[model samples]
Target: MFKVGDHVVYPYHGAGTIQDIEEKDILGEKLNYFVVFFPLNHVTLMLPENRVKTSGLRKIIQPKQIDELATALKPTESSTSKKDAARPYSKENETLLKSGDIMDAAMVISNLTSKEGERTNGLHMEDRKNLDRAKQFIVSELMLVNDLSEEEAYQFITDNSKGA
Candidate 1:
């Protein structure tokens, strides 16, 4: 269980700090919960202690670990064509979102950014929306570990994400 003052990331809610932890009765079930406060959105979330793992809740990544994600942001040489690109793209993004894996989240940013390079017409509305969410998660995490403004985080991702 995460203690108060610890930074954590919730799959559905991005990253935040555990403002407090307390027990509350919900439907007569007295259980523990972590109260998280998101800086970016100014929103507070209360997540159950028991469901932490299933909810994809975990501590923030260190700055050094960002190097790993940076590699994922790099562009690949081969361009494999997709039969029905949007379908797979959407499904993959959804999986990552629900999984709340930081690396996979970074991969989404890299994949979507790189895919934009391949598409002359640019990403569809659906892909663009997903891209926005993916990028926000990355940026949110970066903001916590790296002491960066929102714009700075976005630029950092963009700069490192450009293929070598």
Candidate 2:
């Protein structure tokens, strides 16, 4: 369980700080919830305490882990495109996002990036959405953990991956 001031990432919601935990009576039952604040939007989210594990709430990755993830992003080609062929591609992408591994997320983005005139309408839409999700996840974690601004984190990633 996370305490107040802990940084966590909520899948698809970006990174947030746990502000407090409160217990309230609901339907004659006492339930606990964590109040988290999203730094990106100044929005607050109340997540049930018991659901943290199942909901994919996890502490930010350490610096070493981030470095590994950055390295993974530098490789663009996939050995087997069929890894995602058994299931629907969109569903596979959703599962990847939920994994909360920035490297896996970045792989999805890198694999889908298209060259000029190579993207179809459907593939282009999916690529854009997945890329945005990957960027948000990486940027938010980097900004919080490294004490860098979002813009700086973004630029760092872009610069590091420019040769990939």
Q: Using TM-score as the measure, which candidate wins?
A: 1
- Report lDDT (CA) for all predictions: 0.81, 0.73
Instruction: State which candidate has the highest lDDT.
Output: 1
Mind sharing the TM-score for model 2?
0.82
Tens-digit lDDT string for candidate 2 (3-114): 9999998887778899999998989989999999988767899998988989888898787776776676663544443333222356566678878766667776555542
Candidate 2: list runs displaced more than 4 Å. 78-89, 114-123
| CA RMSD per model (angstroms) | 1.9, 3.6
How high is each candidate's TM-score?
Answer: 0.90, 0.82
Model 1 Cα lDDT, one tens digit per residue, 3-88? 99998888856888999988999999999999999998899988888888777788998889988888876755546576444343
Model 2: colliding residue pairs: none
Error of 1 at 3 (Å): 0.4
